[model samples]
Each structure stands twice: as structure tokens, then as C-alpha cells.
Target: MERDAVIVAGFGYRRGASASSLHAALALAQAGHAQVTALAAPGDKIALLARVAETLGLPLFAVPLSALGATTTSTQSPASLAARGTGSVAEAAALAAAGAGARLLAVRHISPDRMATCAIAEGPDR
Candidate 1:
């Protein structure tokens, strides 16, 4: 059987980000988009991201800092750059976790509280 294409949602957030913050950011990123197949974030943030993944029943990917640095993103945030060495942590995480040949479907979207950010990417058949 042919494998299905995958859509990955990646996140970046403050230290105290709550599940609500993540869900809000995800909602914005998911607007007018297909359902996400997985979730991703920096390895350090994986613990925080786990709640959202568990709620959504999706797999989560812990992208390494090296991989995040290697991926290019559409948006640039000074905070993200200074802290993570990436233009946009949400975008970089999405691209990195989406695997080779993955392309972004949506740029980063911040939560209403500005405590979290999310981006979406679509990858080749899994």
C-alpha cells in the first residue's frame, strides 16, 4: 500500500507556556489547513510539547538544535535567532521534523498571549 503524505506542526514557546497557549497557536496555524499528522519542537521543549501531542493523539518529534540550525525558515525573529540560532523556531522545527523535501504550508503564528508560536509543513509520502 502507498504511504500517505504527512503534515507536521511545530512549536516554540516560553518557559511557562501552558497547554492553552500551545492549543491557541496550533489553532491559528491550522486555520484553513489540513489536519496535522505529527508535532515537533526543540528537544528541550519536547516535554512541554508532549501534552499537546497527547491531546491530539499525534506523534511528536524532538528536533535537535543542530537540525534546527540547519533548516531555513521564511520568518525571522530576533528572539528566536539570539536564543536558538534559528530564524524562527516554529518554522525550523517544522521543516526539520518534516524530513527531506518538506515544504512549509504555513508560516509561524503566535498565540493570543504571545507565549507560544506554531508553524505547519507538509512532507513527502511517509
Candidate 2:
């Protein structure tokens, strides 16, 4: 069987959030996907992103705030807009990191603790 294309998981979280929160958000976002090629988030969240990446064993990509503005997301959040000038940071980061021709495979999903959110975007087939 042919392997599936890479999926990028984008995350957003509050400062001092735990790695387990990120892991839960990622697991919920991934659904049934066997693996994720990368993890992405805003530049300021590098520390948390790095932790999540290390836990998942995936490469990490930091999405700039400028690039995030142009991303079209399936959902909108006032809090994200107020903080990042975008409706959904997770969606925007996933789309931005996935590069051109990317589309969201999963919309933003918040963790049980509500400390983190995650979304998945599929890049063009390799």
C-alpha cells in the first residue's frame, strides 16, 4: 500500500502550558493519522512547539505573524484575533507551514483543559 502524504499539525497554547496538553491537542487533531511530518506554531511559541515536536519526533516549523495574517481558517476566535491579529492561530500556522496548495484536514480542536488548541493541514502530495 502507498503511504499517506505528510500532514502538519499546528498548535497554540498559553504560556507555561504543560507538554501533556500539547500532546492531547495533537492527538485529537490527528484523529486516525498514523504520523505527522511536522509541527508548527507562531514564532513566540517556539519553546512549547519544540517540546511538542520532541515528544512527537517531528520536525518543527515556526510561522511568522506576517504569514499568518493571510491564512484562511475554517473557524474564528476573538481571543486569537485580539492576540495575534488572526482568527485562528492553530489553523493559520498549519496552513502557513504547509506552504502553497495546502488545505486543512482538521479544524481547530481545543484540549480538555482548554489550555491548548491544534489543527492539521495536508500539504501537496510529494
Candidate 3:
């Protein structure tokens, strides 16, 4: 496998998202392109993104979701959510390291207001 990167963003469960972003993500995933998710997305969004990755057998690079700006009811990260309430954060991290057939990394995003949230915005493996 050549191993490509994928980023999905601008996902709003209640508000919805731009057609372009979704289309672009799907196209990129289908074409096997590297990506970095840099949107004001939430934790549930990350979980959904992970499910998409699992379905397509594609590795997803996603942000470390938090409750600071989220409006949903989730209190867990994607890794924790994926483990189905059976693994700790450390174990999940270990699994990500060992069984992670794909690479995922966290990158900092510069806001328009020049503020830093130290968020785990998704990025490509490139």
C-alpha cells in the first residue's frame, strides 16, 4: 500500500457543512490524497471521521476534541470512543502506535485573530 493521508473537517451535525468540503474530502480519500483537518469541528465530528476511516480502511488524521467550544454531549476523544468503553487513554495511544496501519499527527493551527488554542488539528502524514 502506498499509504495516503486524509483529512475531514467543517463537519457540523446540527448546523451542517459546506458541500465543497465534504466533496473535496470524499474525492481526496478516493484518490488517496494527504490532508489536514483545520476547522472549528467538535468531538462527535472526530468520532464520525474515525468511523468513515474504518469503513474505507483509510487512516484518518483528526483533532483532539475538547469541550471548550463543543456543543455536543460527548466527553471522550475519538480513540477512547473507538475502544467502546474498554480501554484507557494510554492503551488507546498504544494501540494507535502499534495497530495504526496509518499515521496520524497533531498540528497547530493559527487562528485569524492570532490566538492559539493548542488544539490537536488534524494533519496529513506527509
Candidate 4:
């Protein structure tokens, strides 16, 4: 892993999802990938993501709803589109929090329980 690289892991989870669910999703998305420097999620989900960030010893970025809705994602989900006006919550959050010129390392990954999703993004500077 490049220590200087800025890699962000974004997550989206259903209400009542356990911390393990988010961790599982993140682990799946991060397998064989660079180390995650940060975590992000929609503003409404920030509190939930913050717990994971704290456990991982990483900062958490709270992406605005408008920004999340505006971001384009590699994977499209009808449920996410209808609820958040984005294709994928995890992907949108990752890109939005990664700042301008960010790109996804891969498509979003879901937890085994199917209650959470995660996506990784790297900033342009990386």
C-alpha cells in the first residue's frame, strides 16, 4: 500500500445494520486493494459510519445529500436511485467525499447479510 495515497471507503447500510455488516462490506470491497485512509457516507448516515471510522482509526466525511445525488456511479441500483437519487450510495459517497477528479477503484460490494454496501475511491492526487 502507498502510505501517501488517499483512499476512501464509503458505505451505505440499511437501518439497524450491525457494525459487523459494514465491516464485512468494507472488507469485501477492500480485498487486495490499497489501505483506506478515510470513510464517507451520506449526511444522514454519518453517525452510523462514524462508529466504523472510529474503530478503524480513520476520519469520516459526511457527504451532503445533494452531492451524493449529483455524483455518477459505476453501478446503478433502482432502490438507491429511488431513495437517494443516486445509482449507488456507496459509490456516490466515495466519489463525492474523495473530492474532484476522484474515481472508483471498483464497483460496490455488498455484505454477506446484504444489509450494507461499500465502495472504494482514490483521489486525483493519487
List RMSD in Å for every model shown: 0.8, 2.2, 11.5, 2.4
Candidate 4 stretches with Cα past 4 Å from truth are 1-3
Write model 1 residue lDDT over 1-126, tens digit each, in one string: 788778999999999999999999999999999999999999988997998899889999999999988999999988899999999999999999999999999999999999999999999866
TM-score winner, 1 or 3:
1
Going through the candidates in the order shown, the clash numbers are 0, 0, 0, 0
Q: Which candidate has the highest lDDT of all?
A: 1
Judging by lDDT, tell me the better candidate of 1 and 2: 1
Q: Would you estimate the TM-scores of all the predictions?
A: 0.97, 0.91, 0.26, 0.94
Error of model 1, residue 82, in angstroms: 0.8
For residues 1-126, what per-residue lDDT tens digits would candidate 3 score against the true structure?
565343423232222433333334344322333343333333445554455445555454342343222222123445434533412222222123222242223322222222211122222434
Instruction: Please provide, for model 4 over 23-118, each residue's C-alpha lDDT reduced to its tens digit, 9 standing for 90 to 100.
Output: 999999999899989999999888878888999899999999999888999999999999999999999999988889898996799999999999
Clashes of 4: 0
Task: Give lDDT per model, in order.
Answer: 0.94, 0.86, 0.33, 0.90
Q: What is the lDDT of residue 63 in candidate 2?
A: 94
Clashing pairs in 4: none
Q: List the residue pairs that clash in candidate 2.
A: none
The positional error of residue 3 in candidate 1, measured at the CA in angstroms, is 2.1
lDDT, residue 32, candidate 3: 34
lDDT of 2: 0.86
